[model samples]
Target: MEYHPEPVQQLILCCSCGIAIPPNPANMCENCIRNEVDITEGIPKQGTIHFCRNCGRYLQPPNYWLSCELESRELLALCVRKLRGLSKVRLIDAGFIWTEPHSRRIKVKLTIQKEVFANTILQQQFQVEFTVANQQCDDCDRVMAKNTWKAVVQVRQKVSHKRTFLYLEQLILKHRAFKNTTNIKEVRDGIDFYFAQRNHAIKMVEFFQAVVPVRSKSSERLISTDIRNNTSNYKFTYSVEIMPICREDLVCLPVKLARSLGNIHPLVLCHRVGNTVSILDPNTLDAAEIQSAAFWNNPFSPLMNSRELTEFYVLDVEPLGPTRGKLMLADVTVARASDLGTNDTTFLVRSHLGHLLNSGDHCLGYDLTTCNFNNDQFDQLDAGRIPDVVIVKKHYPGRRKKTKRRTWKLKTLTKEQDELVARKQDLKRIEQDYELFLRDLEEDPELRANINLYKADDARSVMTNGGTDMDETETDFPEVQLHELMNELDINDEPDEAMQ
Candidate 1:
């Protein structure tokens, strides 16, 4: 192959400045072109940034408010996007400039590149000063004006205790169902969730319907109306009444309903309360579900609750070997723990918790023999067929005066307390209900599956100090596995000082 050398092209003179430059369409020097054609001419050097002092959010034009730190990429992007003609030039680089926090000013340095002439590119840098202006967003304005909510969801359960409500709150927090709620208020027997939009409230109601059996009715109050525009402003209220049934409650089903549910007994224990009420017959170990519609159509209250449970000492337990899941039918002879020293009042009964019970174990039961009946169904039942004692569950002894902190913790929503002062007895009852709920979480693995259990801050210390009081019979206490708990991360809300 023959070696060849390329000839050097001749340089042309600048038309306007009379300087040598590469051949191009404009026929001008780089300095002259830069002076004549300014790419950042229309882009503003100073602009105003609308910020909500209350929420610490920056307003995006039109009607969107966003949360961003002082010198974050989000804030830098917001500043860059506000310029009118920045799109005309290609953005090479953009960053934040440090400024005093009290000055209410954000400075952004932008480097842009643009083609000024044929085969010629011009790059330039400019600083944009954005003064933070105080502005209240629509949501904040409504809150300050005391008309903050467009819709409210009132969740209530007509029960003696707040256990069901507390469980529902945990479910809500786990699924982030209250993320859209503007405010949460705790009432005597229920919770009120306020939303800024009707759709949010509707979504919340749907969530309640999916998680538990609930009967809801909605009503709206007209706030104002515009006749010419055919527009009316109204506040909507969704009264969602949860099923009265709760876990551990004894329900006395109607004779007709009981026959319909696979020939189950009228007296059944509520094993679980979810989208449907799960009831199990302690005598037959037959389980059935009562849907929301079915339950409301034939409304029934709990014949008895945990408050009515009496501690009984199991003298004997003989399993019949008939099994249904974890339950087994057994004949048990029990004597009331309270009457152990006073009298020998022993009663024979059949229970489904035979798989977990043993001789000499303590259990909670209902003493139907001495209780007076008020319902027609109870009066109709044959006196001989009804058991004298019905064991509910195994009783774990050694509960401390002050609750021992657990290795795991649960996240709860921030709620406003009722205006009326809570009675001392009511507060004590609430505490007892909470303690019972915690015990349920420990014993029921399926129940805790839906919840996010975080590792407590002092978990190691508590564990070292004996996390829970141990009973002589260790099998009675169910411990939660450590692996199932997640370490809680602390999120910082303040802007990073080193970002500058």
Candidate 2:
């Protein structure tokens, strides 16, 4: 089958070395545009563009979109909601809250997958084995630990090694929120974007509340999205007191709510009497204002704004992007649709991303154990410290009695694997040395040793040391004695002239 390229639209384009922006005719994005900025008095130098989502700096190949920092259970829950958005994003009837980002880590023999029973059914989980020389941190990255997982949880889903491979058939991309506002300093994750001291979202909410004209409810306004002169326009009536949503309340929603909205602000409005909400953009809405619109315009605004209402939370569990409706990683095409806000509550996904994020691929997940390292430790090219699995939970029930069996796998480093890894490291070192050796030969011929430096995958084409052309074979010279040449003539002339 021929693969057809999807037409490009509002795709965020990044040059090889800058913060990405929406593509421009210049064959570059904003980072490139900023490069053209005329510098006068000490503008800060641009830093490299690193994607907020995953390991890759840009939204490039191989590295999937950033996975949610949230656990697989929560991730799966998010994925399910995104899938369900195909119909509508009604409040989820079932709320399977995941533990915190940091879960407990347990060390166990990982040769065979561990099987455990949850509610008399089988489930699968993963345990990653990590070793640290007892290095301690004041802030442990390990959310789960020895005491953290004292009691095993029977996650509702069953995941198998084979199934893990199966689920990877498509990538369950992580979601990222891109703030297109000109103010970089004000841009922040989730709630932080709102409540900024100098932002307009708060004041705007207050102003909106003051203008609402509610016929029956005193300054209250009712808004109906009906056609005006054959044009779709929001009809409005008004009310009193725009009770904005508090910051703490918005953050309480699961991470999936953000993902469901395509990392865009959620449209969290209440259809009480008046008001509408949209996402922040170069063109419109303050995401920080979502709760404001919902609170000020709703008939239940008074009840919701009371400190007592703090007990309940409302979050838009859909990604906020431009599409018919979905959260796909594929770029947005239509420019106008790119600016959906928290009030719109409509998320759009690309077909490619839509297919990849489907529950079939990233459905159930088992977590790896803990690692003892700082988050900043990965700056160098060294192998990243692998954290062991603190705990794992299956997302669903197994198909059969055997498949229903709960299992967790944690593999210990074997003598062979450990040795192979060491050898690979050695190989890397050798390669570096070889490059230096070649540089020495090129810069100063006298530095050349008795070796033909040619193309060798290892380092150089030395006849000895297992070079590519000739595999070193001590066996070829059977009569040669190992280390028997201490008195060899090669050193005979070295000290003779100097000592005499």
Candidate 3:
């Protein structure tokens, strides 16, 4: 080969000195190559087989046993990200794998697939899970704050680290605590930022409603509102099957009011940060605590005896479960008027709070003896009574020890007499209408085409003329009894002869 010196630009430089090396293949200076080979010599290339979709490890980590935990974490994380976006999250083990009844957070466990050692391929194939959680915030890596979310996850088999499993489990706990703490800090900071400088007030208020859900039964008045300004002064009396929400999700809130845009409650702060929630309103707390009908009638006091407690109001809520599973709907209100005598009322209301159903469910403390009377009209219709609905006022004795006037609200308490008035009014209107129809029929032969008029007349006639004898015309139904008592009404003879 003609050895014309190659252009200097193509020359290789020595790592030791700035001198150019020969123009051979990958021409590092001979000194640099020798040094690299010496440093690289005798190092064993260790590799792992099992690869997790999450940690990408062949071996599963401890405390990541239940698939439910993993699922809840992933799901809660994802949900938080979507709704609140990159929010801090807290996850606590309610000590059991089953979802906590009153928990608003999803619960899941991590899953580990078995490792299939492939002798044919000459490498062990560690099959791991790529399972993501549902109902969780994936981006935020936190759980949700629903009333309850119970999800379970079962792995293929046991983990290999039997020796250090206990230690790892503690580590997991620490991690969870840290996560909850950090989240709480972020939430508090966010609250400060979110509710920053604004008009000053002695104390701003927030509302918290307690809702009970029952699978069966329906009501019209499902929601009732009670506003509370003081949260630190009182706590909601929520009964649970297991444990109630603790300091983690419910922290002691500050006395000074932080400015807010009124978009969300401050109680959500603990939920956002450390699983510690600070509820804002006093009135809402009172209402939520009064889940027990007994409590509603007589304010729970350490000093007052049961006999000393005021008048009665029993909630006919869903039956209590073995534990706190039976939750009373918190939305329904006591419809009786305070001015009315003991348990004397025309109608009561059943209002909704958090959900559509006015009934309680198997989860929390729901008053079982109280019957919410939205209005008797709906029930009356089913009982085969006349169709008319109206609210009647009633009074109840003083609920507070000091106040004596009374509390008054609408209730659906209808006596047979009340219903009778409704029926009689309905019948009288129909009779007048029928009388007009007959006159019109006589006036215009073209009106004969109206079969509806005939049907209505026939139905009304049958209702009035129960028997062939004209004396049987006014037989009594449920609504008629009250009218008879009040008005001394008598049943006239049946008017079948009039039909003839």
Candidate 4:
């Protein structure tokens, strides 16, 4: 059997352009069909942009605010991304044209290029008008509403001091843990943090656990319920309690604890430095470091706070090393400003401040000898009389003044702002590195020749297209020779004596 070729049909004329073309659905040529089919069909004539007034951020769908400056390329990109036309065409370039000065409306000109057929490129330009709308973002809205929290974290310490809270506040700020909190309230001896989610409160509790010794307990209350959908919403609260004892607090240990600790001394001075808590025996000069679990199990009540400390005149001093000190007492009459008595008393001084004290220097310490004993000590018979004095810190005679407490506040940066700053720095560094690379390329004759070869090819193409001038300004990025770059890196990677 012989295969026969089909007869060819006559070409038909395009209805719109009156051009001869193959029969098709619209009976129109490619150019005529393209002209009739609007690429900007689904494109919006006007677009609405929601922005935050206070922070100057654009609303980026759902519940996020983007740090986009007004009339910036970033802002324009965001607006263009929201357009429906962006999804259909391959965007070549976009530019913004300002019509009225200080107006919220912006005219955006977009150039899109698409390949409708093989080796056939179609380029089109369209304008999109934008209108700015003022709307607060989710974060700002929550802050303004104030009652939108779903959880609360109550941080409390049993001690009657605010130093722990102050320290915790600094830690929170340093770690940026408080950024998740919606609001913070200062209480008498603690702080209350309101959060938009329960996980945020839990994360904060975990943060405290990592940094300090904390005990946490959680409770939840039913806020609302949808019986129809069998759904329930709850508000959670996490109670985090810190250890009672703080740094430089004079504490008396229980008899059982004293015996368990090898009968060092019932009179213990709490010294908290960083995450470690040390119980210093003023008499034996022995220090025992206790973990959080052990400290909580056998807690000691503070007999004297650091604020109740009084200044004592050092009549005589026996020099010890940086960690230890001994003192000799004389019958010198010293005026007692703490109202214990004005008498000549002889006592032994064992303190960490021994290295810092001189014969005439005054030190701030607690007079534990004056404390009254209770039944807890009498039962154990372990309430031995404490030392006459325990030096806590070196006190200057004329340096007595009210110490100001540090104020704690949360310092937070928006995610967009942080990203923007990082991007700017990265761009600057990239620019610097690129400039150096370009200079290096110019200095290297071989690399420069390779780049010129590429430029020559581009110039030939322009000339073939009947264009005389090769636009240098249009070529922002010069082609780099990859093999040359690799060779340069290999040469620099050689081991040197200085590196060794």
Higher-ranked by TM-score: 1 or 2: 1
Report the Cα lDDT for residue 74, model 3: 39
Off by over 4 Å in 3: 1-32, 35-44, 49-500
lDDT of 4 by residue, 1-500 (tens): 99999999889998887978877766667777577666667779799988778667787776556775556878888888789767777888898887774687878898887666555556788888988889976556656655788998888877644555545654564456766667666655577888888888889888888877767889999989999999999999999878777777877777777777777676778755345567877555677766667767876567777657777777666644434324222222222344435566655655555445666666678775666655365345444464567777555443212111101112222211123324765556434434433433433344334222113223334446542333343232233433332211223232111110
Deviation (Å) of 263 in candidate 3 = 32
lDDT of 4: 0.62
Scored against the true structure, residue 254 in model 4 reaches a CA lDDT of 71
lDDT (tens digit, per residue) of candidate 3 on 337-416 = 33245554422222222232222111111122242334322232223321111111111222122111111111111111
C-alpha local distance difference test of each model: 0.84, 0.24, 0.23, 0.62
Q: RMSD per prediction, one decimal? A: 5.9, 40.4, 31.0, 20.8
- Report the C-alpha displacement of residue 205, candidate 3, in angstroms: 26
Distance from true location, Cα of 416 in model 1, Å: 2.4
Best candidate according to lDDT: 1
Clashes of 2: 65
Residues forming the 10-long window of minimal summed lDDT in candidate 4? 400-409
Instruction: Give lDDT tens digits, candidate 2, residues 262-342.
Output: 554221222121232232211112232233333333322111111112110111113234432222223212111222343
lDDT at residue 73 of model 4 (Cα atoms) = 78
Q: C-alpha displacement of 81 in model 3, angstroms?
A: 25
- Higher-TM-score candidate of 1 and 3: 1
